[model samples]
Target: MLIGCHGIPVLPPYIISAIVYGSLFALMSVSLTLTYITTKVPNFAQGALVTAGLYTGFALLSINKINPYESLPLSFLVGGVVALGIYLVVLRPLSRRGAPVISLMIATLAVDIIFVGVFGIYSDYLYQVKKVYDAKLFFALTGADFSLFGVNGVVYTAPIALALITASLYLVLTRTRFGLAMRATVENPNLAKVVGVNTEVIYVTSWFVAGGLAAIAGVFYSFWQGGEPDIGSVLLISMFAGSILGGLKSIYGAVIGGLVVGSSEIVVTTLGAQYIGPWVTPYEPGIPLLVMVITLLVIPGGITSVNWRRLLSRGNGS
Candidate 1:
């Protein structure tokens, strides 16, 4: 009787999709947040890192005779390693030289362009391999599909897994000594170095952690979509949307922002616009980005860092 059907609600496919979408966005937001805090650069290389990781992992998934379930961990490892490589070879050296911020952004953008070109080449190779051989070397990856309390619940396990991951990450960032040092570095690097915190090591560690997390995000996304190439096209919009919506500073806000982008953009725009007519029908994917731009214009700082609460507090003090 606990599973009572008093007023049974139907869960739409778009809703389920948004949940998965948002979860991935949340992960990306975390990566952006990590680089932003530690390196003091927006890390425009982030998108490229994601694409590179996706293609590289997809290559491995295509070749391996082993279970895809097993390959997932290794794919994620490849992603992290790739992210760290970009940091070491590209961003770190430039950052140390006190390079212009715009120059760094452009450099990262160049990295992104290179990644896209390489990814296209790799994708073509995969297509040729899949076509010329005309053979599908099957790899078993875990998935689940079942009713959730009599509702047609079809959620990929990866999204839920990622949510758990964010929780664990939150704990690590908030609780660990390394976490404190990381925060210190963000607040003031020179001071942290003077205090003997080894800011350079922390910088490298930030890349590792963030890159590893981005890889994890990639895996979750791949798992959610059931394959590769989804990372670049689909994730790019939602990831940036979530990070911006989250106010770019608060980890908690990022999670909430991901949910908002996922739910509103996918479910609302897809379904709600259906009733309103075909006028705004095709703007579904763009909604998140539009919202993000509008949001930043309205509150330049972000949702979390907005000083409304502080203003209220001052009023209360008065």
Candidate 2:
């Protein structure tokens, strides 16, 4: 009875999917932007980081019989550790050797391959040791969810999580000393070092934070959409599209970019399938690819490059 009082009308599946996926993509895009700004390397392994989180939630929910939502913090911590390990084992050594940016980027691709291999092994081990079903199987927590205000818990939780994450990131970047140091390090590592900032530590911490956020996004994604070990690879194109659309240099831009990409992916794909023929459904993956190419061609600097002040001034004058 109490739940009934607070019930809000439900939305169409397309709209609901857009909101949920948009929020998740926002978290991922922002994390990728942060990694790019600090490390100057577009970490291809970011999808793998999200997969790591999804697997963490899977273990907690399926094996431990805990609420899937309850696993977020642990997933975040584990993701941070995984990201830090990558830096220590692969990227940091390459950086120390004075590798070019292209080399560093390639190194990230190598890390992605390594993580894919690791996930494959881990999936096998989960089945053999814990009697868990094939970890590569697509699975969702739809049955595990409770409703709120007559909406699927995921519908509300995803947006709420996005708000909290965005607010928290803003505060951390603007109000904290670490944030200041991080910004200094990102702007100019040598200058930051001259000013006594530990650039190496900052870089490591940034990677950890980025990985942690990606993990949280993955947790929500698993709740809304079933996941598998290779799910990250499948989602990587969309994540890259969101990050690139936002202007890889600006974290704030990532929010807008992710929302745009996510919303368009669902809405456009659904509409296409409805009107263009059901056969169009399988081509859904091409949406993000199209967006990426268009963005690169039309706005390589992303939406951030637009001169808002000039546009406003012209409007006022007119």
lDDT by residue for model 1 (1-318), tens: 132465655456666677776776777777877777776667666765565544445455556544334555675666677778778898889988989889887887677667667666666666686552311121212232234665322255546666677788778768998878878888898899999898888888778767766776665554445434323555666766777888877677777777787667777777767788666767777888886888789876677877778989999998
Q: Pick the candidate with the highest lDDT.
A: 2
TM-score of every candidate: 0.81, 0.93
* Candidate 2 lDDT, 156-214, residue by residue in tens: 99889888888988898799988888888888889999999988888888889888988
lDDT of 2 at 188: 89
Model 2 pairs in collision: none
Lowest summed lDDT window (length 10), candidate 1:
132-141
Which candidate comes out best when scored by TM-score? Answer: 2
